[model samples]
Target: MAERTRQNNGNGKHVWRGIVIAILAVIVLAAFISSRKGEVPVRVDHVTKQDLITTISTNGKVEPMENFEAHAPAPTTVRKIYVREGQRVRQGELLMQLDDADARAQAARALAQTKAAEADQHAIQSGGTQEEVLNTRSELVKAQAERDSAQKNYDAVQKLAQTGAAAPAEVREAASRLTAAQAQLKVLQDKQQDRYSRPEVNRVEAQVEQARASYTAAQDLLKHSEIRAPFEGTVYSIPIKQGEYVQQGELLIQLANLRRVQVRAFVDEPELGKLAVNQPVTVSWDALPGKIWRGEISQMPYTITTYGTRNVGQVLCAVDNEDSRLLPNINVTVNVSIANKKDVVTIAREALHEDENGRYVYVIRNGHLERQTVEAGIANNTRIEIMNGVQPGEVIALNSMNAGTPLRPGLEVRAR
Candidate 1:
């Protein structure tokens, strides 16, 4: 029994010793793995020389450069509509006509009055017209004859009354007749006294001038009845129909010269300051894909205003639209090239960092990260130009995480 017990005890000791050896090996392996995990694994890409661009993108709308809108000049019926929407017209081409019957009658009446006033003015300036002066003289002669006859009868009646051959009533009647004739003669003499007076001539001339102005105004109104195109353009809109009555100043026709198009970009206030005249602009339409229109900033915003939820400024850009595919008032997207650099070494924008010192990036060299202060040139949304402090063919770390901390100088990194 003692011999059996001794053998069992020896076997137990060997088993415990083997177990301790396995535990110690496991501890050492775990420690080595933990140390390896301290280094951050990062993705890296090498900088290369390529064209770099910086742009500000915003929404915009199209407008016509040369546009015309015609309106009704007065209350009248549209007698004829000669053009429809989307019709091309030349300068002086007739687009519509209004009912001119009333206008023509007005012109005729004004012309007759003007002629009569002119004749009266001429007569006053030259001692009256020949016919008027002759009639006046004849009227004077008739008045004189009547007055003499009345006076002779009154004298006869007075003589007869004195000799008791006529009644008293007869004598009074004769005296009244003579008085009436004398008054009539005096009125005629006064009328002929100032036939060519200055005031009379001036008054006649003033009447003629007033009538002439009315005649001219009526003629102009008559001309307005025929609506003609003021310039060469395309008729884009016509709002009235034939035989429709329209009030004064109502919109009638809209014409536009679409050879050139203008884009009004509503840029946010933060981006407004970056805009300048002659900056290159690219436009794209949602309705059409894979198409682009180019232009330059023709005008800058003079002030800021609110558009929708954004405080924006309007920037006007002019573009060539010879094919006329870009219509007015169409909404579009615009990209303004604020800066550009070509054939330069560039890095991912995610790799850039800034501090009080300056802008910088992390360069991967010898399996470690080196902090580099770089002068950046042009930057787009994804990438940026490295003007200095970094060279082409050098790898840069995209991101580094050290136990929830950012990367810094001398940080070991494993490239992925």
Candidate 2:
């Protein structure tokens, strides 16, 4: 029994020793793997001589260079819409017609009032109307005749009195009759001369002027009732339907010359300094995929404003749309070409880094990273122009394959 127990103990000792040896082998292998991981895998690119284009992209809205809008001249129903929306109309072509019956009636009433005022003004200037002047003249003539007759009777009575063929009382009575007739004639002449005072004449003239102005306003309203295209343009908006009642000053129609359009681009504040008038611009609309319109900077922003969460400046670009496909108020993407350089030393933008010293990049040489300071010129979203410090044909590190790996000087790297 003692011999059998010793045999079992010996087998147990061997099993423990094998298990310890296997654990030591695993520890050595793990150390070897850790030493290999010191060299980090990184993305790399070659600095090459190529054309570089720096552009600023932002959102914008289209607007017409020349636009027109019409409103209802009065509270009236729309009589007819002569031109449909999107129809091109020539200058002086009628676009819409409103119910002008009221307008015409108003105009007629104004005309009648104007004529009456003018007649009154003329009568006041001439002392009276034609009929009144004639009546005054007739009365004056009768007074003059009566005065002459009285003078003749008075002279005859005086002569009789001198010849003792007339009594004194009769002569006196004839003189009194002559005097009364002369007084009546003088009064009529004074009445004609003092018919209208200065204030009265001025009041009448003012009335005439006011009436004429009213007539002109009425005529203007009548003309506007029939809306016409003042210039050649496309009818873009017609808010009122035929026979629809609208109030005065309500919007009715809108049209614009769409051959030439303006793009109001909202550029972020940081990009404003890179913009200038006459810079080339390209615009694209999501609604029309793959279609691009070319333009130039026509105006620069005078002030900065908040747009959503970003501070932006409004830049205006003039674009040619001979086909008129770019409509007003359509949202579009605008790309302003800030710089276009040819045959320049360029590198991938991800390779470039900046710190307190200056801008820099990680140059790869002999499987190791070297921190090289660089002067950058024009840059786009994915590429940058290296003015100096980094020459063409040099390999540069973009980033590490592993997120936890950081790039540093003298660090060993394996290009991926």
lDDT at 213 for candidate 1?
96
The collision pairs in model 2 are none
> Residue-wise lDDT of candidate 2 within 202-296, one digit each (tens)?
99999999999999999999999999899999998888789999999999999999998999999999989989999999999998999999999
RMSD of 2: 7.9
| Candidate topping lDDT | 2
Residue-wise C-alpha lDDT for candidate 1, range 1-416, written one tens digit per residue: 99999999999999999999999999999999987786788878788899988999999999989988877767889999999887889999999999888889989999999999998977776557888778888999999999999999999999999999999999999999999999989977876766666787888889999999989988988998888998887887787888999998988888888777899999999998788999999999998998899999999999999999999999999987776778878999999999888798898888888999999989998878899999988889898998899999999998864457567788888877
The clash count of every prediction, one per candidate, is 0, 0
For candidate 2, report its TM-score.
0.82
Q: How much lDDT does each candidate structure score? A: 0.89, 0.93
The candidate maximizing TM-score is 2
